[model samples]
Target: MSALTGTTRLARLVLRRDRIRLAIWILGTPLLGYALAGSVASIYPGQEARLGYATTSASSLVARAFNGPIHGTDLGAVVVAETYVTLALIVALLSTFAVTRHTRQNEETGRAELLGANVVGRYAPLTAALLVIVAANTLAAVLLAVALAGAGLPLAGSVAAAAAIGGVGVAFTAIAAVTAQLSVTARGANALAAATVGLAFVLRAAGDVLGEQSADGTRVRSAWPSWISPLGWGNQVRAFDGERWWVLALPVALLLVGVALAYALAERRDQGAGLIAPRRGPATAAPRLLSPAGLAWRMQRGTLLGWAVGVAVLGFSMGIAGDEFNDMIDANPAAAEAINAMGGGADLINAYLAAMLGLFALTIGAYVVQALLRVRGDEADGVLEAALATAVSRTRWLGTQVLAATLGAVALLLVAGVTTGLGYGIVTGDPLGQAVELGGAALLRLPALLVIAGVVTAIFGLLPRWSVVLSWTALLVFLLLGQLGAVLELPQAALNVSPYTHVPAVPAVDPAALPLVVLAAVAAALLAVGVAAFRHRDVPS
Candidate 1:
């Protein structure tokens, strides 16, 4: 058979395997973008209102850093600026992780070896994975365009915005492919790809914030800094301003160049090996690696640290912008109402801080779930079997992962609270009190987060194959309910299904102690049942 033979067939197989996953990625992201755009347009209906909001947002460095640079005063531009950067970040990260996992990860685990032995081409797996990502991202772009245009945005701008998002995904997919060839393991590839995107975001944010300030009292309007980042290039397309379509060429060129480089590297590397070979560690395992708990910590510590740093930075930046909301509330009554709904308080800064903390808490919950799911990963890798061969009991093995996850959750909550409180307190002149108050507020949400982690553990015990999907699906439902339910005006009964809805807004509002206690009790019970079930079941072959 030819070296490129069966590539198209493998591509088709991959599409069939990933049909639901692709749909979720493509539909979920654009739907979110469209919803946010429509809501912003409605909230600031008039041109005057849009202009006022834009001017206010521009002054907040945190806002400018998270969102891209605001262009014109139109509602469309404001929506694009506020929403597209985030959307692109999400899409690109998802695409990269998905592609790298199915391609290089499978190869590293020997699954691709089994498949490759059956008439597959040398490069078919990588090619097929890239094709799947491209197709999914293309669908996302088309759907996003339609959704935005249908929401009353101009056709050209909407399409350009969608194309920009797709370009970002394509660029990252190629980057992931290249990293996959360089790293020996899936975790390494994921880390490198994620870090690249994160660094790009930070750079783009720094460049945008700095570029926004007047140097020597003269405003700089050049797109130079933005042009250096893929994300910035997307923003420079100026979707709602004059429709700078030529900017799309940059990401396209980068994607092509990245893919070519990846393929060339692939030809140089051997199957199941990386361009950069794994570095050998100590000849003997560390004393800490003797226990399952220590092993779990060893595996997850890097990821937790990365998340903590991101959360801390995000909290600190948002904290610095607290004072800006004071001015914003005075200028815009509608914005004030939105802030009030998030956390009912007379002090707009406190309310904003409360809302930001709540959002960060949910992210902390996601990290907790991923950490706890290391049990599933261990089971799949046959590591659990090897450990079981020793004197270690199943319960003990499971307990190690669960304990690590719980502690990691607490660590993340502390990091977020301390960072946010320190930043806000220093500016407001009440350092110690604010830190204690915010830290306590973050702690209150832990019960709900633990409850979700317990649910994942229970699913893994009872239905191993369905565990990851169900857990992730639960997260998606929570996200939609928490974010979109308010916008769609959904019933309180439906909204209350999410655990986050139960965590009372802190610092601004009085704590609801009963709900927090109940959540904790539920978490403990679920964990008990899951561990018991795991003890009774035979490990899947």
Candidate 2:
């Protein structure tokens, strides 16, 4: 058989392994697009309202940088410009991670070694992964097209929009295939791919912002910087405006080039190894590594640092944007109602900051859960058994993981608060107090965040097999209720399911001590129950 043979069989294997993930990516992307479209349709129902939104969005440097360059005055065009970049980013990131994980990560973990000993060809795994990602992207495109068209968008525009979004996934999947060859570890490969995606976003934002003429008193050109990023290229496709189909050619061409380079590099490297190998550590273990908590800290510290940095960046950016937000509200009367609806008045900026922090806290909660679950994962992988055979007790082992989760979440929230405060202080010229206050506000949400981690732990202890799904399901429900319940006209009881709802919107509104205390109490109870159950149950065989 040829070196490239059995690609089809490998593709089937990839699909089997990633069935749930593929379903989530394929279905989630378009569903989110449809929901956003529905939201826009509701929020700006009239042409005049849509035009005003378009005008404001186009005028705002931050908005354009985050979204894409506005193409036309039409409502459809406005929606396309506002929503496409975000959707494309999600799709691209998913595809890139999917490809990298299945290809390089599997190989690194030794799963590919067993497969390779079979009929699998040299390039079969990579090719299969690409095919699976491509298929998933295509499904997303089809679903998006149908969803948009069902929502009464012009069929041609819908098709174009879907294609543009899918094209982004295809492009990034190929890029990740290349990165996979270069990086030695799965984490490094994933990071490289994610960084590339972030760079593309930044470049696209720069190009869009620089190329546009400032609608306000400033003189900024908006379209030039967008030309720099693949995301920009996708947006420039302008799904609704006169259909610039050729814009897709850029991503497609780059994908092909990336695949070729990755293939060549793959051939040059040894199986199960990257061009770069991990650096060796000291022969003796550090004194800190000897402790259960220290080992947990070592394993989770890098992830916590990364999360903290991301939250800080987000917080800082939102803070800087606060001034712009106020300026925009002052400049546009139409936006006043929308701003008021989001959070009332001159303090709206603070409200926005609080809401952003709350949402990020949810993500940090997920991070904490995953970190804690690393202990469960270790047990499943037999790593915990070996450790337990050593000097560690069940209490000490589990306590280390839980402590890491709890502490990590708190650290992340503090980072976000401090970053926001610093940025707000810089803009408003009150550096010291804002940072302190915002940081305090961020801390108030900790009870709710911890409650989420506790819930995950309880599930992990009581129903280990279903823990991850249950945890994520709870998060999804909470997110849906907190974010969309009002728009969807859901009931108050339903909205209250999210612990976030109880945490008073800080900075804008005074912190409500009652809810914070209640959440903390519930968190403590859940943790106790989880630990008790864990003590009683036998570790899984």
Candidate 3:
């Protein structure tokens, strides 16, 4: 059989395996764009209103960091500016997970060995994975363009924006492909890919923040910084204001170069091995390192550090953003009300800090999910069984991972809170006070986070096979509810599903004792049930 013999079959298999996942990615991006554009049109109906909003956003460094430059006062440009960065991020993430799931994850699970024993080509699995991602991006682009135009955006701009978003997804797919070849473990591969995405975001944010704009507000930013980063290229497309179509070429070029490199590296390495070999461990395993808790820590340290750095940087930068945000709220009444609602009180700065903590609390869920899911990971790899072979009881072995996840979560939350306080305090001329307030604000959301962590723990213990899926699905639901529930006009019941909704936006309002106590009780009960279930179940091979 030819080297690409089973490519078509594998492609079909991938489609079957990821049907729900693909639907989520392909549909979610365009739908969000539609929602954002429709909301922009509704909220800022008049040109003057839109222009005022744009001007306020332009002056705020925080706005510029998150959303790219605004080119025109037209509704189209407003939508593009508001949605492009966030959409690109979502698409990039979709592509990253899709590739990593099919390629690296399969190999790590030993499924690739079974497939390779058949008529499958050596490269067919990777090829099939890329093809699926490419198809998903293509469909998303078409759907996004249609959705935008259907929503009354200009046709040319709609197509340009959709295509640009697709470019991000495609480029990340190639990046993931390369990273998969380098890392022996799926987690390592995901880390490397995630790091690339993080760097791209920072580079783009830096470029937009530092770039000197010409008087016309015509030249949005310094294109040089954007030129170096693949994700940044999507924003430069200038979809509504004389499209810079040349920018899309960057990701295309990256896809080609990255794939070629991946293939070459694959050729040089043996199946089931990484391009770079892992280092030899200590001649003797340390007694301290042999415990389950120690092992969990060892597995989690890198991830903890990575997340801490990102959150700290975000907090510090947001703290500095207070000056501009204050100026912004003074000029925009709409912004002030929004901040007021989130927890900054009548003082817009405090409201901004309160909002940041809430948002940061949501982001922390990603880490919590990853940490707790180590239970499922260990089980899948038979590590749990081997560890259980010792004098360790099942509950104790599993409890170590749960404990690590909880304690690690607390540490990360404090880091985020303290950093937010420090950054906001220093910028606002009251470092100590702001730090205490914001740090408390961060801790305010702990009960909510614990509920989430407990939910994941419960899922792992009770539904070993479905744990990863159900737990992550819950996390997504909570995240969407916290971030977009109000704007989407979701039902009270839906909003109540997320524990975060119960946590008071601190500093803006006084902390309430009742909600936290109730949330804690729920989490404790769920975790206990999950642990109990795990004890009696047979371990799946």
Candidate 4:
């Protein structure tokens, strides 16, 4: 049989299996662009306002680092600038997860071996996965273009913007295809791809921040670093301005090179093996392996460290940008009102910090869910059964996992708070005072984070099979509600459903002890119910 004998059939299978998940990424990603376009149009309705934004943002290194270089002062160009970096990053992740889910995940679970016993060929799975992901990216591009135009952006700019977003996604899809062949397991493949994406963003951001700006402060010619990254190429497309269609050739070239490399690597590796083999563990178990808590910590420490670094970077960026943002807000009342809605205080700087901190809470919520879901991963892998055969009780094993997750969450928050304060303090020459204040404000978010942990645990206990999908979905819903509830003008009842809504917007509003107490009680109750339910459920193995 040919190496790609079953590519078509396998592609169909991938779509059938991942329809809902793919649908969410495809539809939801573009929806964010649509929302941002509408919000930007409303905020900067006039040419003068757009120019003001261009001038202020162009001169601010922090703004340029976050948003990339400004293309033009037009409404369409502004929308592209606002949404491209974030949307491209999102869709890039979408591609990675999709590729790894179909390729490495199938191999890890032995489904690939089972299929290979039949009519499937050697290269069929990889080819099929790539085909499906490419198709999905194409569909996402079309939808994003339509969404942008529907939001009243120019058609040409909208198409350019969508192509950039989709180009980044496709480029990353190829990267993931290669990473899948390099890693032994799906998790490793995803982590490698994610790290690559992070590097791309940093490169793009660095290039933009270091680039020279025009005399009018409306355009920047990015440095060489931007030219090397796919994200940078996407940005260089200059959507809604001159629209450099040739810039897109860069990603297309990378995609071709990456695909060829992935196929070559695949041929070198044995089935179910990787080009980069996992290191051998010591012959003996460490003493820490004896305890459930220790094992839990060992399992989760790496993820915690990764997230801690992410939040620290976030906090530092926010801190450095705080004072400048206050001035920006003062200059733009419409933007100020939106920022204030997150959690405004008498001090505009404090308000900005509070709003950013609240956003961080949503981000940390994702980590919380992922950490807690380690329990589900263990259960799915049938490792729980082996561990349970020893002296460990179900409750202890599960509770230890929860404890690890909680402590990790706390550490992440503390790190964020301290780093934010540190960055601001370094700028203001009052590090200690700012660290204490921002650190405290960051800790104030703990109750809301705990609620998310409880929710994930509950889902794992009650619906083991659905735990992964449901847990992430729950987090996404909470995130949307927390970030956009006010912007969307949803009802008070709907907003209150998100635990983040109940948390005091620290520094912006005074902390209320009662609400904190109530949230804690709710979290405790959920944890108890989840633990109790998990104790009664059958181990799926």
Candidate 5:
């Protein structure tokens, strides 16, 4: 039998298994583009208005770093400026997760092994996963091009942008395949792949920031940095600036390189093994490991470290750019107006900081949910039954895990505040005051974070089977409303559905404690009910 003999069957099986998942990922970017295109057109109103906004943005340090060069003053280009970077990230992440799920994840769960024992070929799983991603990404590109054109953008530019966006997905899909062959477990593979995506973002940002126009409007380091990164290549598509069709060639080359490397690595490894060896564990358990809480900490410590480092780096990087961003805004009245408008027009830095703080809390909330969901995985693996066979009650066993997650959240929250503040302080020479102010901003998110944790806890206790899907969906909803809804000018009632809507935007508002109290009360109620439910449920419940 050939190594790819069963690839077509496996590819169909993958599509069948992930039909809904694939549809959701493919449709999402187009919908987001539509919403953003409509909003930018409506909000900016006229050509002069849009151009002025672009000029000021092009001159700002932070804007350029985050959004890349504004190719033109046209609304279509403005849409690219605002949505391309965000959309690229979404597609890359979707590609990464999809490939990981079908490849390394299936292997870890023993599904691939079972299939291998049958008629499947050696390379069928990987070949099938790649084919599925290619089809899905192509579908997404066509949909987004149509959606953008429908939203009143130039058809050619829209199609070009969609291709560029899809290119990001293709490149990441291949990268994930490479990562899948390198790590011993799905979790390790995902961590490595996610870190690569993040580094791509950083490289793009650094390249763009260094390349922003000088005071007199001359170009500066952008070409070298951008040329080195696939994410940056998407921006070079320059959709509205006569469309740089050649830039689309870059990701194609990367896809070939990544695919070749992944295939080579996969061929060298066994069905259930990876090119990288696993780390050795200690021969004996420490005293702390004897307790459930200690065990929970041990399980989650590595995850916490990764999140901590990533967030800290982001905060510090933002801080480093703060002074230049503010100074540029001050020098350009048009830029200041736009920045103020986006931030509700008061202490732009603080307002921006507060928004980031809230979003960071959401990231921590996501961590909390992931930590709790691990319990479900353990239960399914019969780890829960084995542990429960001892003195550990279900409540005690789960409670320790919950407590560990909460502590991790608190730690992340603090880190976000300190790093952002430290960055701002270094720029403004007001370290102490910045720390106090920004640290308080982090504290303000406690209630909302707790609410998310409690709601996820209830889902886990009451609906373990649906916990993973429902919990993640809740976070996605909140993110869409808070980030994209504001841009789309969504109805106030719809926006109010997110708990973060009520969390004071800080520095913009003094932040009332009543809302916090009510949110905490709600969280407590949910947690209590969940605990009670778990108490009466069967083992593995």
Candidate 6:
């Protein structure tokens, strides 16, 4: 039999397994750009507004660091500038997760071994996964092009923008493939691949921030750092301003090299093992590992720590940007007005801080879902069932996960709040005071995070089969409503459905007591119902 035997059948099986997931990535990735395209007209209406945006954004280090360099004054260029980094990150994530799920995860679960006993080739699973991701990225690119064109952008620039996004996806698919070959566990592969994506973003940001501004102050020529990142290559495509078709060659080359390296490395390693072996663990279990709570903590602590570090970085960066907001507002009053509208406070600095805090809340909410889903994984893998056979009760097992998730989220918030305050306070010469105030603001976001946790727990108990998909869908809906509701011009009634919509933008305005109380009580009810249901229902044997 040929080495590539049964590849097509494995590809079909992957498609069948991940249909919903693929659909979400393909559709949702494009929709983000379309929504931003539709809103850009209102956000920056005329040429003057667009020019103002280009100039201000191009000149602001904070803007450049976060969004990349602005290309030109055209509305299409503005759309690319606004959405490129965000959409590229999403696409990259979609690619990594899809690849790792089908390859490393399959190996970890012994599915690949079972298939290997048949006529399946050594590279069949990896090949099938990459093919699926390529198809998904192609469909997303086409749909995104159509969406942007429908939003009134020129067709050619839209296609270029879509292609840029797709390139990032392709490049990261290769990166994940390599990481899959290198890491023994699926989680380690995912983390390694994701950290690479994060590194790309940072490199792109650094390049843009350190680059030279153009004569009109509406464009920046990025430094050498950008040339090394896939994101930088995508940005260099310059979707609207003189679309550089050649820059795409970089990612295509990276994809080829990465895939070749992956396959070669795979041949050297034994099946279900990685080139980089995991560190040896202690022979005996720790005393803490005796309980369900302890086991859950051991499984989840690494994830929590990763999130905490990321939050700290974000908070500190935003805190430092706090000092820059005044200069940004002074240079462009129109932009200041936009910030005020989004943040809802008269004081520009406070408004900016409040907006950053909301972002912190969203991050915490996502972390909560991820942590809870790990518990779902335990249940799905029958690990929870084994634990239950012992003296451990169902409530203690499920409740421990919930409690750990809650406390972990709280710790992240505290990290975010303090780091943000510390960063700002150091710049303003009042570190202690700012830390206290910002830390409180971060804590205020806890109720919304809890509401999200409760919903996920309830789903886990009531609809275990749909728990993963439904939980993510819920979080995505909340993110859309909370972040884009105003931009999308949705009705207040519709926006009210998100728990985050009720959380007051603290420091911007004094928060009312009633909304926080209502959200907390609702969260409590959901947690109670979920726990009760899990106790009574039969575990999926």
lDDT of 2 by residue, 300-342 (tens): 8888877877788778877777777765555545445544433
Root-mean-square deviation (CA) per prediction: 2.3, 2.8, 2.2, 1.5, 2.8, 1.4
Model 4 lDDT per residue over 359-415, tens place: 888888888888888788788888999999999998998989888888988898888
Write down the worst ten-residue block by lDDT for model 6: 330-339
Name every residue pair that clashes in candidate 6. Answer: none
Instruction: Locate the minimum summed-lDDT window of 10 residues in model 3.
Output: 214-223
TM-score of 3: 0.94
In model 1, which regions exceed 4 Å deviation?
212-223
TM-score of every candidate relative to the true structure: 0.95, 0.91, 0.94, 0.97, 0.91, 0.97
Whole-model lDDT values for every prediction: 0.81, 0.79, 0.82, 0.87, 0.81, 0.88
Tell me the lDDT of model 5 at 476. Answer: 76
Q: Model 3, 238: alpha-carbon shift in Å?
A: 0.9
- Pairs of residues clashing in candidate 5: none
Clashes of 6: 0
What is the C-alpha lDDT profile of model 1 across 1-541, one tens digit per residue?
Answer: 8767778988887888777778788888778888888777766778766666777766666767888777777777877876887799888888889888878898889988898889988778888888889888889999999989988998988998899899899888888989999998998899889988987787788777876533322122434666788877787787877888888888778878887898899889888899887899999999999988789889888989999999999887777677677777776776766666665567777778878887887788789778877778878888888899999999998888888988998988888887888888888998788778888888877888888888888998898867777787787788667655665567999988887778877877888889898888888998998999899998854
Better lDDT candidate (1, 3): 3
* Candidate 1: clashing residue pairs, number: 0
Worst 10 residues of 5 by lDDT: 212-221
Clashes of each: 0, 14, 2, 0, 0, 0
Off by over 4 Å in 6: 331-334
**Candidate number with the higher lDDT (4 or 5):** 4
Model 5 residue 269 lDDT score: 91
